[model samples]
Target: MDTSDYNNACFAGISSLFATLLAEESQSEDCLYLNVTTPTYRGSWEKLPVMVWIHGGAWVTGSGGGLYDPKHLVNQGDVVVVTINYRLGVFGFGWHQALNNTEGGTLKGNYAIRDMVQSLEWVRDNITEFGGDRDNVTIFGESAGGWSVCNLLAIPNAAGLFDKAIIQSGGCPAMTEAEAQNVMDGVVTDLQCTGTDAEIRSCLQGASVEDLQLAATGDAPAGVNLNMASVVDGQLLPDHPLEVIESGQHNAAEVILGTNDEEIPAPIFIGVNSSAAYDDILASVFPSPVDRESLRQHYDLWQYGSYSNATAHLQTDLYFRCQSRRLAGALTASQAQDVYLYEFNLPVSTVPTTHGLDLLYLFANPTPLLPLSYDLHRDMLERWTSFARNGRPSGQWWEPTWHPYQTGNHARYRLGNILGMEYPHDDTGCDILDSLPNYRYMGEPNDWFMTRVTPLIGLLDWVLDTIFPSE
Candidate 1:
């Protein structure tokens, strides 16, 4: 196995810092390594909180090394931060019956998730040597990383690995098992292998890393049915995250979940300029008559009516905001754990409260920022570090009590130039998601439906201001 190293500079000003690598047994033949970071070396073990971070790349493009730099958190919060690299793209997640046969059904799909669980087990056994507390652990991540955190919360085998969790920009309604299989099939075809399960498995095993990556990069045609994601394998993921949450079957851990205000604008704006293109995308994503009717009523499609921008906003709400709300709501309803919900509203000069913008603030790295970003980072760091330390974010002057999101009173922290609290309402968006067919794979444009239904859903939020008037 290959390995890498970082010097004392990795901890710079932090006292007692160490790093190491460990190999863990995996259900899959591949994916058996994990990397660890800690605050010190010790003779006898002392308990320290551990933060196990999972990287995000839509279950595909990211590595544990990409956005993790543990020096700040380790020194400031007095916690151990472990970042593990898992199999990515086709190698990590692709599914085929032949591979299942090879593993004797012990491992079906979701090898990446299994790898993560193994990594946690390794930490539980060995973290004591590195001055970490095996008993206190927090699993956290952003984007697909957050999605992985949600998966862990629901996985039976992953229950005791962590005590708290922070999921940023990913949540329930992520991806289904069938959707993941469709993605795997597309990758297999792109590799030009025979459609048979055995031949496809052989081709994947023989292909180089670069070859697999290239095959995964092409764009989906306009009307193509597509499914790309981490499968809900019964062994690793018993049910959809939402189902698990609703059933109160998730791990008993405190949670912090949030999303950027404008999550999908850039991607949507790039491809959709005309109303026709916007409608095309919407029609494809939300082809259900009931969903379409809900959208019409909720959005007042007559006003602020351009479907293009509306589509972009709708996609953002569906993928980020709505999902975040659902996850938070589920956890709050559990009555067994603490949950916090927030919306990142800090507007960047080039990016408007967009995806990945919160990274700079959360990481607290110096970057060019507008006046608002500067102040927001300071406040955010104070709150976030406070949360990491005591499961409560401390605010200056007045410590804001983060109330759990509930049926009528959804207390969500609105983080922005002016930091405050508010209850979000986008009735149309909620209605569409609630009424849309349950887990239908094809026929009506579900993908486009997400894009079209979101903005109109947001318009319904206008009612929130009137109903619950801000102080």
Candidate 2:
């Protein structure tokens, strides 16, 4: 991470690519540029399928350039790959509505979200110059990146920017206005800035980025906070993407979505953790005692062998797998075309096939740099770019012919260790979890203003989760 190390590597004839990547990227307010790689075709004007990537860090720390390399995919499929950087943490999701007063409706402070819309607009205007077919653009991302793709599909302004979308391990959930207000209040309090709106804004602008970063993280884990996410601002994003899809108002693009076998560890579910000092963790996720009990009765921790291990399996289903299956149902029921679902169950002896493991395969950017000919490396690139070129993912010799998900009959694909085409039922737990009374609005400020109360937990969750996270 030291610039001097990068300079030394460059001078030693180690690698210009490595040294340049480390040197070029700076975590600044202006880190919103796209990196493009065109297929190595003979003709410079050869039109190719364009795949735009949105990096993920739960809306906190991520950049387009460093983590993923698009060259292999681009060259193999004769496609164009674009990785983008956008605002994160405080700068991205800081919701300052009255920064300059004057009834500030226009200043919705969703600078990070706005950056995406602008980036897509930029692609629409300029991608053709890079030998990419702008008309056939496909937007794909993982985790929070996947979350952004789903929301963008529902956005009115983002209607014609792309024709396809691939969401991996992320379900779109936007914060309601009132919930957003509470989060903003918490941060402003943390900064100890009490004054008129204009004065507070000035103080905030003068504060160091370190101060802002610290202020941004208080109750939530690093890179994950309800506050630092897209909001239902009434102007840009009218409702949650799930609701919009149901009403037949979302983008009608062909969709591909799925989650990892274990999207995250149990600690994230803090509500029912099996780790050290887990008592305090529960309070953060499950605010109500009744809800906690209901959740307690539902699981038998002994079955999974250990608390941490049990919680990991439980959370994988609840947070990730369930939402993915539900999205498949939601999109398909709404008459979406070629909607495919998948579960990555591959074995990683070196590492568990958890959340963002898909990135390790799809992008040939492993730290030690795995050989380009590695089966996983080549197989994934072929599948992703093939999907970008056509709505359906091309099946490899060993893989099954991937099928589109339908309402009742749930058929899909599975990758990695138990890799093959199969009807995945790993998310059957959603049947009960989705219907829970306490688990509404995806919990907390996503719809906290209207449904935070325990009495109407089930109905409110059903309504807001099915509609928009009510304000």
Candidate 3:
């Protein structure tokens, strides 16, 4: 029952960042606890399907508690829901040659991901005691959590811990050794450790959690601020997630994956006020002039009304939507598992269908400020729990039977005002994004955010405040 906060990195602003900040004062480094809820009405001898939730915060912030209520999924869906917490930021994802496996320490990175594997181990061993079917476990998460689920699939130790996965806005990518070392170099310089590897390891070990957190914060030596992501440590994670899946070594047999229609909010495009500004930003990200023109042609300014809006669409596709489709295709192509894809297009509020909005309905926690349809909540819960109960999300009760996302039709379910099937999803934009030589599924041009968006911080401050006014 020790649910004290895990010492996570400090973050600010609205959305999950606000919640992460509010818990900063009380967050404990000893926060690896999980909560399980099972239907009480179920027969005592019957074991319900289990669903494990991993919260998302770009791999830096977020926990598996609070706002993630599972009562509806437990009671109505007749399933067992478990939400677990893990270490984040530097304490969880820091990497240094001094702590490498070759140097006699564990992988020393991917600590957060390993923490998840451990939690799943606990579930596999003891979930049956809580009226959960250990063999029928499902791991589901959004954003970073979704990313974590994909990582778990690649880990040899995590194989067979879960049978199904639901990845919402999760992409398959991992930091290479060099990329991870870049982050570690920043930590070493920030900690002022000047010596041999052993001494540096000692110095890092002696540093306070607070100091490490500060060292990993923005403008730290890494130049890749908040670069807290899983690393391919050659042990726990042998290769990039997509590569592992493509090689037919992944563990997931059935999966449900998709992303929000608009993964990037307007506030993120603060500096792209004019078409010229947008073009400048594009020119910097895309190497070739022809590719930039093709990008512009694909996302026409006239169609989007404003440059900022156009930027939102382009980034959303590049980062979330189209990337998810690629992962879905990989899952199907590898072993041809039953993969169900979705797009949360419901405009539940004044804002566009931005990231993490589906959680409100998925968790059945509606807010008066942005009231969502109860029917939509029911639909989401049923679809998820049904998928957990069986490999398919389409139950006998469901109308217009949801089909698996095959490579041919690109069929996917649309969870919006009208919940039904959508066929042959158009992804002409992804073709353009794939053509970008600089872009890889794994984060490349590693200093991308620092080079492109860091300069826009001053301009985005007012926009963020306007959109999410402080209380």
Whole-model lDDT values for every prediction: 0.63, 0.67, 0.76
Reference-based TM-score of each model: 0.79, 0.81, 0.89
TM-score order of candidates, best first? 3, 2, 1
lDDT (tens digit, per residue) of candidate 3 on 1-471: 344433332332113334344454346666777888777688456788999999887676667767677888898889999998877777777777877644557556777888899999999999989888999999999987898888888899998899999999877658888988887788789789878888888898898765666577644222224476788878888888888998888896799999988888766776688777877777656767888899898787677877777887887887777778778888888876798999897645465888888888888555566658877787788889999988788644746688888777778898888788888546678778777755656553233332245235644545655775533
User: Order of all candidates by lDDT, from best down to worst?
Assistant: 3, 2, 1
Per-residue lDDT over 1-471 for candidate 2, one digit per residue giving the tens place of the 0 to 100 score = 332211111010111222233433544554567778876663356578899999776676667766677777777777888888777766777776545253644767666778888989999999988888989999999987988898898899898999999999888667777767677777788888778887788788887665666566543321124456777877888887778887788888899899887776544443334443233333445577665455555444656655555555656766677777777777887864779888875455455677887777787543444322255566667778888988878857666677788666678777675455776454345765666645523423333221122223334345534553211
**How does candidate 3 fare on TM-score?**
0.89
Clashes (candidate 3): 2
Candidate 3 structure lDDT: 0.76
| Ten-residue stretch with the least lDDT total in model 1 | 11-20
In model 2, pairs of residues that clash are 346-417, 437-457, 437-458
User: Alpha carbon lDDT of residue 386, candidate 3?
Assistant: 91
Poorest stretch of ten by lDDT in candidate 3: 6-15
Clashes of each: 13, 3, 2
Q: Write the per-residue lDDT of candidate 1 for residues 116-169, one digit (tens) a residue.
A: 899899999998877777887788888878878887888899978888888898
